[model samples]
Target: MTRRDYYEILGISRSATPEEIKKTYRQLALKYHPDRNPGDKEAEAHFKEAAEAYEVLRDPNKKRIYDQYGHEGLHGAGFEGFNNFDDIFSSFSDIFGEMFGFSPGRRSGRRRPSKGADLRYDATITLEDAAAGTELDLDIPRTETCEGCTGTGAEPGSSPERCSACGGKGQVYRSQGFFTISTTCPQCRGTGQYISNPCTTCKGSGKIVREKRLKVKIPPGVDTGATMRLTGEGEAGELGGPPGDLYVLIQVRPHDTFVRQGDNLYVEIPISFVQAALGTTIKVPSLNGEVDLEIKPGTQPNQVYTIKDQGIKHLRGGGKGALTVGIRVQIPTKLTREQEQLLRSFAETVKDTVKGSGKQKRNFFKGF
Candidate 1:
């Protein structure tokens, strides 16, 4: 049988970190899981290949041997690839535990108190606000535990009854050929209990939807797609569990004059060709204010200069980054008659000077 390089199989470089390998494998598994692909043979093959690569690379010893000696090293140590889909499933019985809900393995013989779902809020702010940092009130709509029955889904006086189908285990286990599959109990919907007398406020769901005003602090230098987590601000947890978090997705509006890279700000300052020949000082725009920048004599176009402490503040409390200014020497698009005549005279003078010096002619305009 032929085998592909494990790194290539997983679409990762050989220098990929362990966390990177795991994250990539999780993505590939979700995309090619047998359940998701149904009857696609190619998808199943890819799924198996990714799983095999992950299994070897995750183990330090196996990876070391495989890196030193190719696939033959594993075969020499009595390790062959999975024989079939059943073999792969048997090896990783609860592989989808953290991924899909198929084999959640989330239940713990009793109702588990899992954290509530995390919420996301998209916020658009001005670039100035991102550079200097600002605070904003975000209205987050989420679920809160019903106060009437204290999240029991029962009326004030009455309580829920244990589910008879699952015997309060919250799941039903059944044999599927060589595998035992666990699914949510249909009678209780994984809640482990049935509410005979439902709460009037939450309507037997044990939670109520409400909008909350949360004040979130936006840190300085936060770029677009930056996610800030507000702890314990998500939906109320199930049963007696802790609440999840709220992630704020920040999007900074584009600046009119500056482009930012990391903490550095880039701005192009257009100067006349005369200034390029004889250097001059100009006021450059920065996040703070206008700063004087000195241009050197015979400065080339697109020459970059750095203005210290004029960029965005550090996300964490540190000094500001630099503002980089690129010089753009603008040539005259249309020349006046006198200006054209003067330029032609200058060129002729330089050509005559070169010939008189008994030197070979060279392109002198390149210096400008």
Candidate 2:
């Protein structure tokens, strides 16, 4: 079968730079990798096609020849001889490991002892508590270092022995084709030691699951999705390694009256039609307490009034944010017969005054 253009196979332009070409190849390779799309023949074919294209285009001399006369120009040019599929696969595997934050060089020697996995705990606090900053005691269930045998995982009065599988080197070598690769010993898991008589308390795991109470101090201005890290508060490590970290993910409860944006607080205050028409000082709720706000005469609906420094405190350091009160003018929907009659009379008098005022008439005409 005739092969497609290398650039077209990788979905890149002929003039694409080297960096752009490599990026496109990586994306396609990741999407069609055999491990990711297991048992899919079409995906595997596409993956091989993209890999072949990358192998040719990545080299400057081969790319120049291919660009000049296409693939046929490079016929019998030893391009296939220079390309090693194993090397390409290894390079792409390293790219994936770095992207996903996994162990690098999976088959290279004994892997570094795996760190204890990070632990996450959800902490829910009220908006007020978040604004003021509060301390909380959390009861967490997690794996801790075993007190029995001091985390040795060996039976009392006995000790673990060096693993015979890897001869205490913690790694085993294997020959694939002509290449020799070293990998961790499956028996001892690269620890180089094994407990002959396992500890009954921890069952040779060197750790036990227990409930612990931790005190956490939450700073002010912490919103939902905020995360705080506590050092060395996570799971116990294996074979005397360092413990992992604990992450406290914050979840702020919704407030009854206020919505927070960063440090700013927003709230909608309803004002009667009479209060909006006539200027008055009314008390409004704030983070600190109730504060009086002056509503100007002839205030329109959705007008915002800002109170300085009355919002949430800054999470880092420095000044607080402003509290914005959005005024919502409420028009009365229900009224008594007497109130309806009075309102109608008031409306008629206002119309008569507008007709009598020359300035009001000119202003109305100007708007038109």
RMSD of each: 12.5, 12.5
For candidate 1, write residues 1-368 as lDDT tens digits: 68899999899999999899888888898899877788999999999999899888988988998999889998898777787765665565455543454543432334567799999999999889999889999889999989998899999899999999887778777766634567778999878898999999999888999999999899888999999999999989988798999999999988899998888899999999989999999999887788999999999989999998888888877898899999999999998989977776776787644333333435455456
Give Cα-based local distance difference scores for all models. 0.84, 0.80
Kindly give the stretch of ten consecutive residues in candidate 2 with the minimal lDDT sum.
100-109
Give the TM-score comparing model 1 with the true structure, all chains together.
0.61
Q: By summed lDDT, which 10 consecutive residues of candidate 1 come out lowest?
A: 352-361
Best by lDDT: 1
Candidate 1, 285: how far from true, in Å? 1.8
